[model samples]
Target: MKRPQTVRSRGQRAGLDLDQIVETAQSFEVEDLTMQSLAKAMQVDRKALNYYVKDREALLTILAHKAFADEFSPDAIRAAEDWRDASRIYASSFVERALSLGKLSEHLWFGEPLTTWSLEANESLFARFFEAGFTDEAATRLVTMLSTLCLGHARDVIQATGSMEKPRPKALRAALERLNPEKFANLLRILDHGYDTYGDEQIDFSIDVFLVGAEAVLKRDLRR
Candidate 1:
């Protein structure tokens, strides 16, 4: 049997080799990722860093790609039994991965024009939905919805926690208490148990709603 050839990534081919840079950058807060700081950490001249990344925006794009690539694998989606399963896996994996990244998640949330690998990975994932009977337009919309849901949740969690590693129950309770009890009664009641306690529940609720709507759309499309 012949062995398959291994393909090198663009960074490796160009001597840009961004793995070290990405790893180092992830350790710092998103606000602190200036080119000079990254170059200093990498032991390269600031000007030389441009040889690999071109600019801060490019570096951020590469970092976003690295983070997503670590969490999402094309083969995993391919191995799923159905489009629904693939989407659930994608959303869950993406949210978990983004959360785990700490401050690094900001790049994934804000970066535009994702790297080639990231784009290709997303295309493959969405293509599975199309193959599963959804029209091209429907698949595109569904993908957008799912991605937005996950990213939005991640952003909310980040804001809620601020620089803290976890949500502070005391702080949340105090904030809720400060609101007018009569007008915000429902809001306070919902968060009485603490906002952090509902993270998993909220994620489940959002995913359930999305999947339900998606199924309805798919059924309607099929009937036409």
Candidate 2:
């Protein structure tokens, strides 16, 4: 009786392993990179790759979480002390990483599992909020507000400058000076009331104001 030869696992097939897989996924082109291409790079059969990862979406989700964990894990921001410094560090680091990724973030935001991974990985943002002076409800709202601002501004910054740059203190201060928190709070209240209608330009303008207010509050609290 002739027995079939056993196929090696992806780890055995590729000298490079799961760590390599994660890194390869991050470094690979978000556009052209595919399951077949990843399988080739991994030196594994596509079917075998499918066994390890369900689909291209699954692979990207894994990669996104890995990349995010690598970038913003708690230890990564430990030097920032409590929530205030932590939040600023988060903003700066996120923008820096997003700038480095550029178009890849756009792909991830538009993609399935990747988008889920990105949003899920941001739970830490709320954790940081709680550590700061926010109650659970406030923390949730703050995290949502900050996430929208940060991600939207990140896209805008990349588009405007062709890359992400360090947020300028002077520039931030200048923008913050004109912010009307009462108006911004009212807008948020409107949003909470189920208003799905706002122009992108208005949202962006409001967010810029929010970011300034957030930073200002952080500074005041931390200084006290």
Candidate 3:
């Protein structure tokens, strides 16, 4: 049963703040969200939504930025054992949150006029690098490195999962299967299982391997 729509007067909407707008927007899927739908959901005129967001692209930019920012807690980050642990936590948070967004995660690297997802907004992450003895230059670079790794690998995981439903390369496997059906079958079976087994583990692998590589870079610099 559909409930009755609650229409508010112009005066009521005049008090509409970004927080209310953002909160209401969260109820929508990244694809189905629009000024008209958002307005309907809020039972306001579509112009009210457009007043807050000029267009769907602008709305997504704001929503994505807010979603990313809402994923972290400075206290949780501070509770890590060390910088590596902190990186792991942050990376996991980033990957998990981005994956939850499905298509919207791709906007992590994008920004527009009023976008607010900036490194300075999440200073806890940067402060972790500084506390771990990295110079300002290295710390900033590591932040970029982790962000790139998480975003790239998250995209990989998404593509791999989608490819699971796609046709497998049976022709390539057929030749291998003729020689050793057992090994080739096992090698390709992970994809048949939906390529989901290592999705979470892959995030950890990226962070751990990244930390090790970053440590080596620091040591190499010390020898300079």
Candidate 4:
């Protein structure tokens, strides 16, 4: 009887592809993810990883871009009822997507030559803003400010809560207790209803405040 040829395992050697490496790497927590760690996960020698990706920087860049492209809708801005509503939708969606990445959010850098999906979303936003009477420069600044705010806010939340949903502030509450009641009375008062901490609601609060200021600016420009 003729026997079938022995098959080799995909993880047994350097017979690997970039997509395979990236897909496997995505399963690991960002902090624990490294070239060596990924290699270990694949059951291949670490050098095998280098053959596919030049180094860790190249690999991480690919990962960061992939994460953004996968999570965000390129037409999200166009789905809103109005230009102002678009800002709210985009800002809130951006923050939520970043938050969902957990510690991986820290590596979410948009390098030069942005992805097509990213550019598509920004283009929609710009068109919406222009139609709403904003100059190119004004629209650019508005988008930049809103995006910066969302990224910074998401980073702060991730650092404090480590992406824990509904995180309890046991440590923070205890630390607040140690402060002198006279000097920190107001701070302690928040502990009664629970510590006043970052949450998803801030996204709306920030966007609303931003829109108020933007409306003022637009009205002032029109009066000129």
Tens digits of per-residue lDDT for model 4, 72-147: 7757689788889888878877888888876677767664453553676678888898888887778888888888
- Which candidate has the top score in TM-score? 1
Name the runs in model 3 displaced over 4 angstroms: 1-13, 43-51, 110-121, 162-198, 221-224
Question: What's the TM-score of each model vs. the native?
Answer: 0.71, 0.53, 0.68, 0.69
Model 3, residue 117: displacement in angstroms?
5.7
Sorting all predicted structures by lDDT, with the top scorer first, yields 4, 1, 3, 2
Q: Show pairs that collide, candidate 1.
A: none
Q: Supply every candidate's count of residue pairs whose N, Cα or C atoms clash at under 3 angstroms.
A: 0, 0, 0, 0
lDDT of 1 by residue, 158-180 (tens): 66674443455556567767776
Worst 10 residues of 4 by lDDT: 162-171
The C-alpha RMSD in Å for every predicted model, in order, reads 8.1, 11.3, 8.8, 7.6
Stretch of 10 with least lDDT, candidate 3: 164-173
- Where does model 2 exceed 4 Å of error? 1-20, 73-82, 107-128, 160-208, 211-224
Measured on C-alpha atoms, candidate 4 has an lDDT of 0.76
lDDT score, candidate 3: 0.70
lDDT per residue for candidate 2 within 107-134, as digits (tens), equals 3343344444455335666666666665
Q: Which portions of model 4 show Cα errors greater than 4 Å?
A: 1-18, 39-54, 114-117, 162-197
